[model samples]
Target: MTVIDLVAQADGADPLETEPLYHAIDPDLLDSLPDADGFSRLEFSYQGYTVSVTDGTDGVEISLAETGVSVDGSSGDLIDTEFST
Candidate 1:
């Protein structure tokens, strides 16, 4: 999923090598949220990042919260988390 992809990207590793997204949130619930009438956003922590998914008229936007540590155990900084699909 996007969270795993982003985390893997930040770590400079293959997405498959990253932790499973389901470990941080319910994948099935997340997949079904767009169909929920009033659903707009969801946030959860994966690895060392806080993942935020916002639903809008344009599309779903994914972002990561700034943290003090990264997946590689270094200082964390915000990456390009503002993307829609």
Candidate 2:
């Protein structure tokens, strides 16, 4: 999935109806992904989710607001911690 599709899934909205990706990253940033030489990655928060795009990958990853939960998981905190410091 493209970054835009992941953002749409994260927001529970239509891809076209969601905020344009241009609002989050420069349009050219995406255009350059195809020519990555090494481990190129882009990260940004949009529509309440943390988005991660890695070069040479066909999928876009989305996580919930960086609150210790992944979008596709249906469980408690994935990180085990009793204290927040």
Candidate 3:
């Protein structure tokens, strides 16, 4: 999937005022396949906040470095944490 796709998935969790800067693995490597089937990390710059998402076999983790907060979820509500800059 493209970076935009990751961002879209994340954004769908909640409506936020922060703008997102999306980045993803290059989508042009037709001959190449990732070692993993899911996303490893998704990061974006919203307003001044840097948000990141990491997925593991067991679950997904979301973090906001600027707020020094993080959330981990396997399935359920979207975890929201606010870091203190």
Candidate 4:
């Protein structure tokens, strides 16, 4: 949900109006993944961008592929919040 929300935010679209998340990945499998020691991570494409979910350590994180700018799911704050022209 956090992942979808942030991507929608970046795209200036409503979360509900954006592409369905399940079309890119399985929500159940995502939820079932372990979050121990920050080793568990999942990367998939959604809404034309690569979405990465990293659990544990610093909580859930979602980033735009290799953009370096990432959203911290727990805080809803952008990390490395910069964009190149």
What is each predicted model's overall lDDT from 0 to 1?
0.74, 0.55, 0.41, 0.62
Off by over 4 Å in 1: 70-85
TM-scores vs. true structure, each candidate: 0.74, 0.55, 0.34, 0.63
Please name the candidate that would achieve the greatest lDDT relative to the true structure: 1
lDDT string, candidate 3, 1-85, tens digits: 2333333444454334323333222334311333447557666554333556566445555455332233231234334544321
lDDT of 4: 0.62
Error of 3 at 63 (Å): 0.3
What CA RMSD would candidate 1 show?
2.9
Stretch of 10 with least lDDT, candidate 3: 22-31
Candidate with the larger lDDT of 2 and 3: 2
Total backbone collisions for each predicted model: 0, 0, 3, 0
What is candidate 4's lDDT per residue for 1-85, written digit by digit as tens? 7767777777788898977778888877666665444456777866556677666455655666434333332323334431211
lDDT of 2 by residue, 1-85 (tens): 3666655665568888877777777868666666756646676755445555655345433333443544455444534222110
Query: After aligning candidate 1 to the native by TM-score, how far in Å is the CA of 4 from where it should be?
Result: 1.4
